[model samples]
Target: MPSKIDPRRSGRSGGLRWPLVWNVAWRDLLSTLRDRRTLVSTILLPLLILPLFTLGMPLLLGRLIGGQAAERQKVGVVGTLPAELRRSLTRDESGRAGVELVSVTDPVEAVQSGEVEAALRAVTPLPTRAGEGSGQLELYAKLGNLKGQTGAQGKVESSVQAYNRALTLSRLEALGLDETALSPVTLRPVDASPAQEQRAGALAFLIPLMMLSFLLNGGMATALDSTAGEKERGTLESLLVSPVSRGEVVAGKLLATTLTSLATGVFSVLGFLAAGLAAAGLRGRSDVDAEMMQAMGGQLTLTPATLGAMVLIVLTVALLLSALLIALSIYARSYKEAQTYVTPLTFLIVFPAVALQFADFLTIGDALYALPVFGSMVAILDLVKGQITPLHTLLASGANLLGAGVLAWLAWRSFGREEVIFRN
Candidate 1:
């Protein structure tokens, strides 16, 4: 059994030594585990709250948004379609499909005031502007949510096209022109599975990104709470006075943060898989059901290399952020004050990550595969799409790990300085 030495005794036994690091780390970990708030935040929250908030919540919201956009659409009709023709149009067949015509107005105001989910304007005449050739029925949707706008537009356009086809045939017969003369070429669109198209629809992208970001975010909270939070609570000072080298202290704290981060990532991923499985079983024969459930039926899995890379990246990021946060936290007087320090650090960690969210999946290329968070996004997108290139994966993982190393070194150096650690 290891004996605890009192720091008060400055005899050789009281000198800072290797064992203090374990002592501090063990105490911190145990104390943290016992904390209701800490347990909830570190373990339970990721397992429970993240799935509900990030995955389930977003899915529900998407449905509501899609539903709301489909109901009571205000439409502006222009040109020679005629009011009688418009009145003859019955929405009974389409209304249940979520297309309710509210009112007609200027396209711009309808979109600006949110009076309509979209506006249908006649295309402006020109040598033709960029999208003008899309023809007389123009759709103006707020903020360019192309999916909803395009779906709604398709319904309206299909109705109009059918009406036009009927009228054209009547006119051709009355004018003694062959109906065949109106045809230039036969047209048919091949309807294929959305899966075959590799349609990385909104939810696919959102789920993974949400998982990665929240795992890191929640991990950050754990890191800060474990280290800096201890410092704020005055518990760290007690440990620092004991026998431990600064390096061991850093190593142990790094281990704790890495574990916390990995836990968060794993729990979040499990939640995603669980929800996905349930959704698949619930959807039963719906075309939107993910092919992953069938292809990898009765089992959810990640490739070993992919899982390794993800773990490495999350660990590196968590350690780097924790170190930086701890260094910053040392400057504060209390836990509350440390929170203020962490607020900006949180922003720093989160803001750079936003670039990942907006990156174009269709346009991803090598250069972006080298950019920091952008690189992670590209790598992850590739992973989910089942097309991860080992070369790109290594390069991105290397860059992120290398960057994290530099940040961790800086933080370690800061922690070593007594002036920094005890800054008033």
Candidate 2:
């Protein structure tokens, strides 16, 4: 049996020794690696989740939209069609009349009651050709019922647009003007930055959130198991009685958890890369490829410096999260209790990740990069876009390391508290 450190030798023992740290860390790391739970969370989950989600999501959405469009919808038209339009136009290029036109006594009530998918009302007389009165047409659908309508709703809207355009042309021709008379200033969009198309794909924005999620999910198990699990199993006392300093013990657990999380993040990255490659392979083969390419945003244009910066940022975040989890876990009496305490930390990533979608609108300053999870996320966002801001990376990394140091210090102190260690 190991013996506890004496107060007389405490000063000397309090000093960190790498050999002792490694010994303690190795014991936990070896046990964690062998555990099936670690294998599932750290290896299998990371390797599959991203690719399956990124690749499968687009396909699923496409199926849903296409299926919605395919289902013939009931549209209520309140007014009669002009003789000319009734004869000449049954469907537009998108295959009009794809919907069934029915007469409804109450258009509003019909749509509200689900008697029709949508309703169209001509506020004025229908214009068949040039030299006619131009007016508005109202198309009504259940706006709040997005799920049931989805892509199929677009067909109803387009029919109304066609009606409005037809009326405009008729009015213009009546007034002796051309179609160009509809607008005094027409703006045509041009590609100002073709290079951007080659850099960040639409999917790149997800990288930051995914990376943080990887750290949290992959590291949480190991962190909880090492700290709370040891205490729960009544094994913490045996380790505490060893000659290892409390600081060294905390450092060792932090190191092990950080390493495990980093590995999981790496595997998650690999899953994304694999997804990208799969999309690239399908490029130009069919419309499926087009949809996937658009979903993926663009091909990876990452340079080594960018990858290195990502790796560096990932490491820092892992360290911080690992330490935070360990600290929380050390304070809990049981593994279940530790989980309840640490699970709320998910909101730390959830809020920033939700914000990442609107990144184009936000103006983030350099100092913001010094925030904990949010900072790393922003830096990684820039990195994913191939922006490679060294200052941002440096700021985020420095902040994360500083925060980790604080948390690790607290955990180290916690390790020395008998009440905390043996909490019932």
Candidate 3:
């Protein structure tokens, strides 16, 4: 009798076969690609949306809000501007600088009422002699407003900082003391990162989360469709009745899901690359807030080594998520039901990624490298900072692989169950 499965993707006879697994995976993948919309959303959405957000957003915001360049911001001052403050107030925070001082009867009320961008309330009269007395001022701006904080508050702070510096120097001169007395300890920051790390940027923190997000989103529809969708469509029984082993079928579906997830991650990395390039291109331009651009993402230089490391981390994540999602999807009788089981897992990946934003403030122990998703997150974050610690990377990837193995085993067990297979 002729074999029921392809010789290229399945063994003539099998007890857990790779060939059969690949065959099943390819079959499901082809089915998924037939849905042209999924193909486009999976491949093209990230490429288009990420660049639009990263690059286009600032330009959109600049024109809409008028704070990126030398556009003058309104800052209310309750008292007369000292000679020192007058020069400082001529500038904002980014680009060359621009600030328009507006005298207000009520500085705080002016800011709250939107009559001013920010307000500086003078508590003490402007000192004529720096050594004789001190000047006190209160700065007010809407704390919850992003534009106000980033644009107006930044300008006020810079002017006040400059004013403080000038006053300090004058006081030192009045006291007949050298500048050295002002600082018992001078801590100068030095850049110790490698040349390739020049573009590590603030957005590096998002790389780990980006990997998780793509892996989760990219593979989810495929995983649900492969398991629950097949079951709901009544095709799962036919596939099960075929000559292929249950483990082989599960392995195939898992592989298909992982590939889909990996594809999403690849596109996501491309988006990150695009955003980085856009930031670099805009960094030196005069029309935009170049300083803000650098601070936000700066130059995003992902070295070949970093890309390789990211691939390693993403692979482990895809595998783990694929197996887990497959297991959850297999337990549900309907596609919509599978979504209920799988939706919460999305939040599990997210909360950890959000917590990583404060990674700089936290102390990560060596044991964290052995965790599941968070471990991979840490490894990816290290790669983002241009810090390649091989042991941690290996540990995290190995842990994810180990977890994936267990989940894949559970999924294989589920496929073997008569009740599970026919659970509709």
Best by TM-score: 2
Which regions of candidate 2 are displaced past 4 Å?
1-5, 8-15, 83-97, 147-152, 167-178, 181-186, 191-205, 281-301
Q: Where does candidate 3 clash, by residue pair? A: 9-19, 10-20, 92-98
Put down candidate 3 lDDT per residue, 1-424, tens digits, no spaces: 3123334323225467688889999999998899887787678876776666656665565554554335677888887767668777874454536678888998778987889888888788877456657778888888888777667687778767777777788888878987789787999998777643545556666667766876888899899999999999989878876878777888899999999989988887788788777777765676544545654552335777777777888899899999999999999999999999999997887899888889878899878989999999888778767776878888899999999999998998788776777788
lDDT of 2 by residue, 165-270 (tens): 7777877887899898878789997655344343346666677887788889888888988989998898888887777777778888898898889989899878
TM-score of each: 0.67, 0.86, 0.81
Our model 3 lands, by Cα RMSD against the true structure, at 4.9
**Candidates 2 and 3 compared by lDDT, better number:** 3
Residue pairs with backbone overlap in model 2: 131-174, 201-297, 201-298, 202-297
Candidate 1 residue lDDT tens string, 376-400: 7567655655566777777776766
Comparing 2 with 3 on TM-score, the higher-scoring candidate is 2
Question: Which regions of candidate 3 are displaced past 4 Å?
Answer: 1-14, 53-69, 73-104, 119-124, 129-140, 149-187, 196-198, 282-288, 298-304
Off by over 4 Å in 1: 1-23, 48-88, 94-161, 172-199, 203-209, 282-301, 349-353, 361-374
Q: Ten-residue segment with the worst summed lDDT in candidate 1?
A: 125-134
The deviation in Å at residue 357 for candidate 2 is: 3.2
**C-alpha-based local distance difference test score of model 2:** 0.76
Tell me the whole-model lDDT of each prediction, alpha carbons only.
0.55, 0.76, 0.78
Note the residue pairs that clash in candidate 1. Answer: 16-243, 17-243, 17-244
- The TM-score that candidate 2 achieves is 0.86
